[model samples]
Target chain A: MQEIPKPTIRRLAVYYRCLERLEQKNVEKVSSKELSKMLKIKDSQVRKDLSYFGTFGRRGVGYNVKELKEKIKEILGLNKQWSVIILGAGNIGKAIARYKQIEKDNFKVVAVFDVDKRKIGTQITPELTVRSLDELDEFVKKNKPEIAVLAVPADAANPLAERLEKLGIKGIICFAPVTLTCSIPVEYVDITVFFKTLVHFISRGIQ
Target chain B: MQEIPKPTIRRLAVYYRCLERLEQKNVEKVSSKELSKMLKIKDSQVRKDLSYFGTFGRRGVGYNVKELKEKIKEILGLNKQWSVIILGAGNIGKAIARYKQIEKDNFKVVAVFDVDKRKIGTQITPELTVRSLDELDEFVKKNKPEIAVLAVPADAANPLAERLEKLGIKGIICFAPVTLTCSIPVEYVDITVFFKTLVHFISRGIQ
Candidate 1:
């Protein structure tokens, strides 16, 4: 398998999403210029990023919408469904559970776990049922979810992340603001920092 | 004013957040090595990034935690509260309105607007009241929210963003997956793409 840079992978996902819109609008093809204009990126950057995989676009005619969309999906490893388990039923966790993007992106929220007994047994949606953290080890061992989302408070983040790491979980999406150091080779994306940056950019304006 | 790279700005935010944690733990000073270990970044990179602003760290003694934290906050322009508005009052919007990070980061969600009558006039929280899209123009004109968060669907993203642009909103945080093009200069951060990348990195493992 070919290795793709992380930044390139994110651009591929963006391109895939853009193609989805074009496909819905019945647009047949998209040039790098068009894609760049819509995405606010340089056209050369878009073409160069796409060129890493193969020549999916015609020089003069641009890229075939349907073909480009599929190619991006295949490249980003989004062609197959991945099961996701969200830890913590707090505001952030529940927001993610109800987020429409997860379903659109083909990630299935299999279950939600929280330490609060009051939240246990409640339903996020009909598809996702809340369970106690006590069941986490058993559920993870039995179900083997591909992705684990950490939505617990800052105090709980590191310990829970360690627990997820021990469970042999591959990926962790952490919402807590606390910094987590993991030796067990888990990938973590911090949403609090992400949102903070978003707010910072908006307030300070991008340079 | 200096032009700071977007990635650097993001790192500054992360450092600010980390420093906040360190302060709460009563850590008076931190070396770049310690900060890097805590944030999972290279110590050299951390020092280089910090050097862009000024000589923040001493050669041997490292950095003063509280001083470094305050400096980052000042550099990122987070010392003042930023007024924000949510374009959609759906599940995600409501969750953001109730999220504690907004308050922690000193961002105030002044209002939430949606076209759905069922959701309009509903209270997300006591501070944030739901308003109709009909009032979008007037509310923006009157309040002049510095940051506008696009939580609307893909199809509605561009149009709503355009409206926000015309109304003189400075920055936008896009939650929709679609590509957005705006006449007014806007900083677009796709939360969906961020989460998708997190999931991808976790599932595939980051090298």
Candidate 2:
């Protein structure tokens, strides 16, 4: 199999989102040009990115929006449901647990864990409660959530992540500012980067 | 001046962050190999990325931690203060407005605006208030804030962004699921991407 560039994979996710909006608007078919225009990506670039996964569009009529979206979802492994756990019950953690994981189908929060005794056993949402850190390994073993969202402070991030990975967690979406040194995957996020990157892109606006 | 690649700019920001950590640990220098190992980028890739911004280190000695970090900061223009506004008073909006933008040093939220009458008069922080949407134009004109975090829902995202751009707002970090179609710079953030993309990355783990 040909390895797609990381940027191309990220762009595929963006294209998936665009296709979804198209589906919502009841727009069925779209050419590569339309998709490129909507995303401000080059038309040739779009074709090159999609070519890594088998071809999708008809020559003249373009591509079926629903079909292309589903194909990307399957390629991305989003078609499978993924149970998720939040490793901290901080503000960001609480917010993420509460937000519906609709785009991620099966990827929904199954539990939230924090060290704060006060927050432990408290309800994050009616659907999930803040569990004690002591119960994390045991609960994760039982339920087998494949992913964890690490929202602890930077100081606590590495330790919690090491433990999460030791307990068989496959991936982490980290809100804590620290970069993890784990063998398993870690995606670091900071709310500020969204702004900084925006400014950078603006300073060097699109070609 | 040479135009840097977008990915290189983003990586420079990451290097700035990594160097900040190294500075805290009293680590004075880092080889491209060590930095690449930490970030999982190729050693040559690190050298090439840094070269785009000009020579930063001795070939044998690697980079001075503090000096390299400061250089990246200047290159990315993070050395200055930026007044930011939040365009919504929702949960995510409220949280972003309240969180100190101290790390992005000087990238602080100066005001928050919402169309909800009840929320419009409320105080977000002792330092900030939730002004009504009607007051946005006047306030922006008077204060001249160039950056905004768009936390409004998708329905309100487009129009508010359009209005913001017309008023000369330069950059936006949008949380709404909808994509913005504006002439000025807009950065879209859907928190859900953290998990979905993590899953995607883990599914297609490094080559």
Candidate 3:
């Protein structure tokens, strides 16, 4: 397989969501131009990115919405269920655990852990309880979650990520504001970056 | 003076943060190579991105960390204070309101509003309280927040954004998992996209 650029990977996920939205609206087919207009992406760029995976759309008929959605789902590994563990019981962690869409999207929140003893044993969701970080070693050995969601503090994120990588975690979805130096894939969900982008545009009088 | 690419804008923010960390550690100077190594960006890419703003640094002496950080901060509009209103009082909204870093970053949570009657009048922080969405019109009229944060449900995001645009909101930082169609700039904080990225990498055995 050809190496896909990271931005293209992100755009593929976006295309999947856009198609999902189209399906919900009872739309059956979409042209690259239509998709690009909806997403503000270039039509040629959309075609080029999708071609990295495989051709789907016909010459004039465009692509079948459901078919393309499912194909991108498989390409993104969203077709299979993924077991996930949340590493904080803070607002972000609890919110993610309580997010119904996660289960719907084939990602399961198998467990939640926190360093706060006061939060330990507390129920985040009826199906999930916050566990002590001290129990992480035993728990990981037993349940073996594939992904770890880091919602911890900036200072703690790096060391925790190192441990999670050592424990064989495949990837991390980090909500912390720090840079992680783990060998495993770390997706930093730095909300402030979005804020910075907003300020930059606002200051530039773009709006 | 030039039209900076959106990706470069985001990178400027990243460079500012990385430099801030260095300043905290009393690091006085850094080369493009050192910054790129810390950020996982290409050295030439760093120099090119920074050059879009202005030329800095002397030959073989590296860039003064404090001077470069301040310059990027000014370029990104982080030097000026911004008034912000969050439109949802749910977990994400509350977390963002309660975040102490916002004030540090020069963005103030001037107000928070929600559609839920039960949540209104609740204190999210010692300084901020949740107001009814019904009061959004008056609040925007009276206070004139430059930015509106959309943390509401996906379905509610678009219409609310339309209302905000009409109310003279400069820009938006949206946390809802939906495509917002507004005349103003919208910065989307789609956490699920990050999840999709992680799953893609994990499934591809990239780590």
Question: What is the C-alpha DockQ of each candidate?
Answer: 0.50, 0.51, 0.72
Quality class of the docking in candidate 2, CAPRI style: medium
Could you tell which candidate, 2 or 3, scores higher by TM-score?
3
lDDT of 1 at A150: 85
lDDT of 3 by residue, A146-184 (tens): 999999988899999999988889999988887788888
RMSD in Å for model 1: 2.1
Query: Candidate 3, which segments miss by more than 4 Å at Cα?
Result: none
Best by lDDT: 3
lDDT of 2 at A187: 72
* Clashing pairs in model 1, backbone N/Cα/C closer than 3 A: A171-B202
Q: Whose TM-score is higher: candidate 1's or candidate 3's?
A: 3
For candidate 1, give the lDDT of residue A55: 90
Q: For model 2, how does the per-residue alpha-carbon lDDT over B7-79 read when each residue is reduced to its tens digit? A: 7876776777778889989999998988998777789999999888677778889998988888877777676
Residues A86-174, candidate 2: write the lDDT tens digits. Answer: 98887778777867644245677889999999999999788898989999889989999988888887789888888888999999888
- Candidate 2 chain B lowest-lDDT run of ten: B97-106
Candidate 1 structure quality by residue, lDDT tens digits, B1-207: 567777887788889888998999899989999989988889998998788778868988999999999988877777888888998988777877888777778888888999999998787887767889999899989988887888888789998988888898877777777666775434445656655666556545564
Which has the higher lDDT value, candidate number 1 or candidate number 3? 3
